[model samples]
Target: MLPNYLCYVNSVLVYRSGGTNRLTGLMLAAGTLALLLVGPSVIQYLPVMVVAALIFVLGIDLAKEALWDTIGRVSREEYITIVIIVFVMTGWDFVVGILAGIVFACLFFVLQASRGRNTIRAIFDGSIARSTVRRHITQRRFLEQVGTQTQILKLQGFLFFGTINSVEDLIRRALDIAAWQRNPIRFMIVDFSLVSGLDFSAAEAFTRLQRLLEAKDVVLVFCGLQPDSAVGIALRSVDLWADNGVRLEVFANLNEALEWSENEYLRGMYASGWASARAFGRAMTGAGESGIEAARTFSGASGSDMGAHKPSTGSGAIPGLEAAGLDIPDSKGRQPAFVLDSGFENSPRRSHLQQAVRMALERTGGDAMMVGALNSVPEIEPENASSSASDAEAGLEGSERERTERRTASSGEQLPPNALPQPGDGQHQSHNQTAIQQRKRKLVQPAPLLTLTFKAYAQEDLGQEFFANLAPYFTKVRISKGQKLWERGDESDGLYLIEKGILKARYDFPQEEFEINEAMLAGTIAGELSFLSGQVRNTAVHAELDCVLWKLDGTNLDRMQMERPARDFSTFFRMLLRVTEEEQECLMSYLVTRLS
Candidate 1:
């Protein structure tokens, strides 16, 4: 017979635990040799041996990660029970050990099947290095903001007879805990949202879990259950959950389920939906594989310009699979699919590309007020603007003209545009009379960048008037890996920010050059001197990785003349400042200690 258990254990352990779970392979290899010498009896019992090894190894791993204090907090019976199960599985015949542990396994199934799959799907709040989101949002088209919680989790699959033993052990062990008693679970909702099919074994396992839960005063509910499918048929027409048993209301709509579940009576209830197609999609359908395995087939907007703010959305299109977050046409390119990105080498958005373009364009003619070229944006509330103008007219039409005349005569001189207006100069007041003209501030839809910090920043701080006007003037520039933003002595025309990919800023010394290493993470500011001075770039920016940056035109000399809020631009600056300050402080502390 094929070694079913060994096959899966070897395959799964390698993928899930990587090198940490490699013991199974070694055990299996040794077991093969043992069988050659010991004969069939030992070999017949091999499955249990592998399982035992698995439990001990897994437990050891868990212990390594566990807070030992919690071990004492649990009761002895559960611990002994766990130990027995592990011994039986690891020490005896694989088939018999598994068979002997059936009681514990049964208990496990009863508990797990009762709860089904109430999952935890959250957009991890922090950097990829610190969080799991980066692992899941690997595809180039999976437009996820570093911190945006737009990513979702729809739990799929089901628990059946095969996993029943695990279910029982989990239930029994959980009940044995002091915490469970102190904070008793009253209700649990199993989301069957994505359960397309169910088998009898799983059905049997579910019943056991439900019964065990109810015994502990915990009620079970099911959601998103499609009645015609196997799980549906098993649940709707079976034992522990028949019409006579506790009937789980299957919801086709989510809002209805939410509405019912929100009742005060259901306050202590914990229920996670079981997504069927949608749930499977979370694992299978998205733009990319999200680094986590089990989700293999993924899709993305590969081989296309993503963040290049083209009024024509066509430029944002990807050649194969379109990205998840862009506003590209819905029907073009590949259908919504899931692709896995193991390394975060490829960014989900083209923000870096766009940034690089804007930076290059800035040299041509840059704006300081706006981070990117500002397209004329009509006000959202035109009527509100008109009303405000009308209010100004009313304020001006009445005593203001006479007041201006009196002030003009008293001042006795014509005021220049550069002069700060007093109460009024008759002529200076005349310009206000023609109407304080309102410039339709260009509205540019900045491509929003999601950082690992969960903070989102858009393209170019368009809030500043200088950059606002400069945004429209911005153009596209491309650079390969290790290329500098500008060479030393090249007229300092503009500055660059990492829009999508990685970039670095280096200062050239007499013999060599040095660059800020980690401090120059994405969202960093580079070439500020070039934009500020009408001279050549003092520092050279080299792309450590293939990068894209927003370039502010060097020629837009008037853009940086004054500091304005630049509205939305402040947020990006704040992010850069935060990263820079933290790094600078570390350096300063080192310098102080060295000097002392």
Candidate 2:
């Protein structure tokens, strides 16, 4: 019968369990089988130890997720429970740790119940307050609550001096902040209110607080100190240190205590510096204030000597900007700073960091930031506002100074989207920035240096399907400034059909007329030698404005050669090369006719 039941359970587990749990269950079952076959000695040292080690690793993971403060102050009773279990299960009988920990936890709860006390809540002023006053506990009850409003702490079992630490820290913080504190209480409504209790140490601690508050003119109010109890009325008689200041009040009715608390609260608020601004009487009595003095009094600091405006580009060096921030613009010291505003803390940093991440993800095609699983942290922009404007003449790219002055009053002009340049050492930085701008110009026309017009004719008659098949074999590549696509005198094996961007192909020579002759843009083709023969490259290819062009290799031609229309275009290669020439001429025309 038991064997049948076991089989049924095994079928359920096998169907429902997944990888991790199945592995764990298999380990446990194998360990149990080993114990049965090999006896406890050998099995305990091997499989049991391995399983226990894995379980311990799981515990470590749980501990990492727990809050630091809670872990720091684990109760002494809980510590003893863990320590005792560990001691019992260190060697031979290892499973005893888990069993002992569970048993001790249950025992701790039992201990709490054996020493518990209950205090009743008293109602007054349409709200229930924490206090002690007259109540019915079999023919005798005094005021259920008393004194100005405060916290109620109910004690059970023996009172020790250690409890003092808890009371003092709780009270001080409560005075400044309107939150329920867990330590030194300002005004405590210790509900010995129903504590038919007495301990010299606990009684003395309460006395000390009352006196300490008196010396500092701080108040300590107590509730439910019964007149007839052994330690009750006597505690009311003893002086706290010396000043017989506001004597702790004992009440007979809950309502009376509530009425008294409301009056006291109002008086305390009036004593503080804040009164309603519209209170005419206080204003007439010279209690009102205005202007800088009033602002200073509220903030509580004097003579800071800070004049108004923020430091500017003219104010010399301010730190904390890096490529980590925006690239500071190439017009540095020549342009106004890019000021970013944000709706979050460290506004400038929040905006810069957010923009930096967006630029990185876009620049790298998302693969750079997204690995197999976790998203990588993008580069962080530096946190401070940086100003790097150079001298007045630096703005000579035009009268940029005049434009800046005209826009000075307007806080709205922001850094262009093109401002987040790719970052690295000086080497790739310029190239990456230029490449991005060049591609953007092709797509959105943000800027354009050249344009090309093209018309294609078949070198031989062919069909449309042939040309369509060959079209896909072409791919575009973008290169930034100083990127050596090919070196001079080296073999250029593959073909480049320029679709956009400035690729200036020049033979290295010094001349008075022009340093470069061919400025390739849309519909230009180059690099046919090494690409066909698979030989060494020739002619260095440097991107003028981050160029993009198509790569048409031998495989591309081979695939399209069978297509009728593609086969018809015997001079198709030369037409693509013509496009490169037109682009280069356009750039040269711009340089000589306009700028020159």
Best by lDDT: 1
Candidate 2 per-residue lDDT over residues 381-448, each given as its tens digit:
24411111111112221233344445753766575534422233365456645543333222111011
Model 1, stretches more than 4 Å misplaced? 1-162, 168-225, 238-455, 458-462, 470-596
For model 1 the TM-score comes to 0.25
Q: What TM-score does structure 2 among the candidates reach?
A: 0.22
Candidate 1 Cα deviation (angstroms), residue 476: 22
Q: Which tens-of-lDDT digit does each residue in 433-479 have in candidate 1?
A: 55433122222211212221112122433332333344443344557
| Model 2 per-residue lDDT at 7 | 48
Worst lDDT run of 10 residues, candidate 2, spans 368-377
- Residue 214 of model 2 has an lDDT of 55
